[model samples]
Target chain A: MQPKRLSVLGVGLLGGSLGLAVKSVASDCRVIGYGHRRATLDAALALGAIDEGYDDPAAAVRDADLVVLCTPVSLLGEMLDRIAPFLADRAVVTDVGSTKASIVRLSEERHPGIRFVGSHPMAGSEKRGVQFAQSDLFRNAVCITTPTDATDREALEAVEGFWRGLGMRLKRCSPAEHDRLICDVSHLPHAIAAALVTMQEDAALDLVGKGFLDATRIAGGDGGLWRDIFLDNRQNLAAAIGRLRTSLDDLERLLTPESSEALRDWLDRAAERRQAALKP
Target chain B: MQPKRLSVLGVGLLGGSLGLAVKSVASDCRVIGYGHRRATLDAALALGAIDEGYDDPAAAVRDADLVVLCTPVSLLGEMLDRIAPFLADRAVVTDVGSTKASIVRLSEERHPGIRFVGSHPMAGSEKRGVQFAQSDLFRNAVCITTPTDATDREALEAVEGFWRGLGMRLKRCSPAEHDRLICDVSHLPHAIAAALVTMQEDAALDLVGKGFLDATRIAGGDGGLWRDIFLDNRQNLAAAIGRLRTSLDDLERLLTPESSEALRDWLDRAAERRQAALKP
Candidate 1:
């Protein structure tokens, strides 16, 4: 029951930082990182995120009590398929993936023998890789855990404890609910911001002001990661896109020459909505 | 010419802040503010952004050697017309409106007798009013000036000199060029963020990780003013939206099942582009 050793996959930003955070907070824990790139492994090693780095997933997960998947969302399923046989029966596998539904489904299929508890630590930066990684990135941030009925309660408890130990506030949700919730709060916004920036190439280039900077600060995020999120939570993302379009369309109507008063009223609601959203 | 006095119209964040900035660096210059709101006038007086406040547009501009319009783009022309009759013949009249083309056009048609130069200090926040005003807001920011053929060289020089005194980095461009540039850098991003955040009311309520926060932070801006910006620069805004959509579409394609290489390539490019853009 005591997880003395932890194995981290994809030692880039999320994985490297996770190793760094876990190793820093729990000094007794031995953290081993598995990186796809030699450069990434070296950087993570230099950063002291891990005692050592392994090039092979099988070699990395051999005796570790925990294996944390830190790769891209698109690679989550494949990672499980590849690392499944190497994992010990007692080893709990978790991921720092953005969406939960697909990861949960993949876990149920690919790692039936090993327990998987999907986690999303609400943290990070516009910067990527180990260099941008910080030990305290998840501190005071929300960490959601989605555990299916097939999940072992023991594994869930241990994952929750790890996140809590890393200074995260943990919440529990169903895989379906987590995906839908994340689509609204996380994924859909990326699509809207990206589309807005991409669509207005010339105008955006010419007149980027503080408002634009504030709006698209996240637009600079890795597009591939966001795109995977959108596709994974397609139904929820579509619904979110629809809701947002209504807001934009309403503004468009209010902007019509005859609707200045309506425009003012809409803005009041928007400002009110914005301030209200910021309260938490 | 020894300009003995100055006038500030609108008396909100930009106008009030400029009034204080102008007075702080040029101590001998007497500055007064004109605003429709009694509270704005009181706040401006309390903030010491103005020597006094005025209710009458004509009275405010009559004895002033400098007049800076700091209201919404929609009202700049009407305001110029209202104050033209009382503007000092030798005075330099300018504005801090977001979009320059429309305001400059307004100035050209409305005040042939008075010297009009258009300006936009590239700064601000969603939090407004005189209380949020600061004298140094203009001090290390870009001060954009839009000079037309009708613009007097001496008037432009005086405007530039005044802003320089406030410690601004002055940059000159045509009003159309200014609008075009801002569409890319400012207005488009706001539109995108706003739309993105609104996409999923429920999802946004749950997952809002730092990525979403960074992506949609500016979605919380003053909607009325932003709506005005969107309408005013519809053509450019539309173009920006288009470009962003293409980028999003391309990313979406890269995330689909068969494109792991493309996904990695996109993330690498995205990281590179963002890092490059972030560099000074």
Candidate 2:
């Protein structure tokens, strides 16, 4: 499953990190990166993240055995369509988008012949650009692969193996399930963090301690990137928000003096659950 | 303003840490700790966090020049009542309770001659008890003092100087204002974090990442302790939650295709605000 000629479209944080990580493991493998900006491509080349760089998506994937779309969630579909005609016949394509159902469905419907497996390598920070990329970015992190019935079996396995080779733990699920589950763990939390930040008064912000900062840290991510993710997975995110509101309602009900014990029990349960989820 | 004899009621994390921190700066000061649990008091003694320990609150504060009530928020008023009659004539009293208005008001009305000043040192970890106490726990952290009109000027200055001597950045405001502001920054975040953890499905919990963990870390604090704070400041917390809901509703409206640009702007604003709030 080793990609000898890997083409990474959109050489930002994830793409540049992918290039470095792949090169660290497979030094002889050639990496080609594509970015709309000449400066970004130049930066990737200067960092030795890519052997060569291109502004054209078609040129980037011309001879590559593996092609990964590393653009924003909203641009994934367009990138796939542009690279479809120029992809090598044996090329196995994938993406690093957070949401899966929309892009996975689009790929299945538009390019049925092209083998494309949806992937979300959940390893990154609030940082952007190739300058922040790390060679071990994916190491020991979870990489989820969303495979529908239309997905080619070999391509799914290849994508999973590719992530595993980069020292990632692999998880497989349907794209719809991925969207729903991830909406709860990732998207919903991001939206809530943003809302928390938005709701604060300047006086409150001035008094913020380490807890508030950590609670809202995810809200500091690039908005354009999250905007795409939120819109793409709006349905699941909306439902997740509804569930969160219900949780908040339950908490409100326990705010009374008569429910003092109940409130403590509720908080204790959440604390125990979260503690259990922590990696020992 | 240095107290020769300092009494720390409740020999838990914050109380024990306060004793150690005070001892680090002023070696001659004698620290007396009171805890219902003999084992906890013994642990504080073994850690060198206290010079003497007592099960009775009055015994703990006897002959003390300063007294810090460190019991749970619900018990703070009772602790004050018990220690009031036995306190030295010039003894200045304070508390480390998160919510200030109730206790501050109670002290002003019930124990007017006690020289009580409400303090909240924005320091501590989810980890509990004297075993986790560190001398540097309050160093460089923000210690907010909530003073009422009834608060004595000399007592307020003494409490402020005490915290500053322990290397804490001091801030002062009226008791009601302190509770309202802190509810937005601290208590609301804790409630929201607990809600976030509670709303997650078991499946999503299995896939939790670093971001989710960080966002919910405050939810791991001692539930009984938070329950007291939440209940005491329920009014402010409820208002804060309502504001957060309004912010979320605004975000929901921007989740459409037509509002794509607007959505990005909304998220960008939150991101920018959070970024600006970060420590340089």
Candidate 3:
């Protein structure tokens, strides 16, 4: 299941970190990175994130046994298309896109023979660029693999094994399920964080404390990246927002003195749930 | 304006921390604490958070030059009532309540001639009790003082000086302004975090990452404490929620391909604002 040659498309934070992480686990594996910008390729090279760099996605995957598409959600399909013709025989392809259904569907429809598995490493920071990449970025983090009936069993196992080798805990689900569940955990939170920041008065922002800062920390991520996620997963995200609004509506009803006990219960339930979900 | 004797009327996390912080700076000052539970009082005393402990709030304030009400928001007015008749003449009184308008107004009207200033020291963690008290809990944190027209100038100055002495950056405004602004930054965020946690499906909770945890960390606070804050500041919180909903509405509109650029702009604006507010 070990990848002998790994090709990472887009040498940004996640891609560059993937390169470094792969090299750390499989020292004998050759890591090749692709980026449109020469400066990014040079930075990835200097940082030892990749042993070889290519300006062309096709060139990067020419001999790679494993190809990881690390571009933004909007560019994932295009990247898949660009590398579909050049992927080596028995190559198992995957991606680190936030959303899954659209990318997975696109690969299944347009690139029939490509052994592609949709992966979401669920690891990253607000900080961007190859300079911020770390070999341990995916260590102990959840890496979800979305597989469909059309997915190859051997390719899926190889992808899962590759992520586990890089120190990730793996979870498997359908692409639709991945999008729906992740919308609640990831997309909705990002949108809410942004909305929370946008709704603040200048005076309030001045008086913000650690709580507010932490609550809005996700809003500090790159805009273009999140824009693509929100747009791609708009339906599920919109539905999650509706559910959140319903929760807030319930809270509004409990904001009265008569509902004091109910309000405490509501807050306590949330607190207990979040506490239970904390990593031990 | 350091007090010769300070009475802390709750002996909980904030109260004990205040005592420890004050003792660090004013070694000669006598610290008295009040708590219903003898065990908590003993814990506070054993930890050197207080020089003395009392079960009676009135007895706790006896002969004290300064009194800080650290009880829950719902009990603040009652604490003031019990201690109003026993306070030493010219003793400056303050509180560490999250909301200011109701408490400030109540103090101004119900306890006429009492030197009271509404203070919200923006400190403390989700962890409660005297065992979690830290001497530097308030260091570099913002302490907001809400002064009404009827507030005694000397008492306000004493309260502000007390917080500043504990190494807090100080800000002052009218009680209404304090409540309104804090509703956006503190109360609203807590409410939203709780709602975010509540709306999540159990499946989604399993996939949550650091961002989701950080965005909802404030929801892990004590439920009863937050219930009081939400009820006390319901008016402002409701308004803040309405504004947040409006922001979400804008996001919904921008979740289309036609508004893709606008969506990125919206997210970018939030990211920029959050980045600009980062502590240096």
True contacts kept of each: 0.53, 0.84, 0.93
How many collisions per candidate?
34, 0, 0
Docking class of 3: high
Q: What does the lDDT read for residue B143 in candidate 1?
A: 78
State TM-scores per candidate: 0.87, 0.96, 0.97
Best by TM-score: 3
Candidate 3 error regions (>4 Å): none
Which CAPRI level is candidate 2?
high
Q: Give a tens-digit lDDT track for model 3, residues A1-280.
A: 7888889999999999998888888889999999999999999999999999989888899889999999999999989888888889989999999999999999999997999999999999998999999999999999999999999999999999999998899999899999999999888999999999998877788888899999999999999999999999999988999999999899999989999999999999999999977862
In the range B122-226, model 1's lDDT, one tens digit per residue, is 877766788888888877667788898889999899998878778877788899988888777777666656555444464455556666666656656676677
Best-fitting candidate, scored by DockQ: 3
Worst 10 residues of 1 chain A by lDDT: A198-207
> Where does candidate 3 chain B have its weakest 10-residue lDDT segment?
B271-280
Report DockQ per prediction, comma-separated.
0.46, 0.84, 0.89
Error of 3 at A127 (Å): 1.5
Candidate 3: tens digits of C-alpha lDDT, residues B1-280? 7999999999999999999999999999999999999999999999999999999998999999999999999999999999999999989999999988888889888997899999999998988899999999999999999887788888889889889999999999888899899999889999999999998878888888999999999999999999999998999999999999999999999999899999999999999888776752
Q: Kindly list the per-residue Cα lDDT of model 2 for residues A29-74, writing each as its tens digit.
A: 9999999999999999999999999999999999999999999999
Of the pair 1 and 3, which is ahead by lDDT?
A: 3
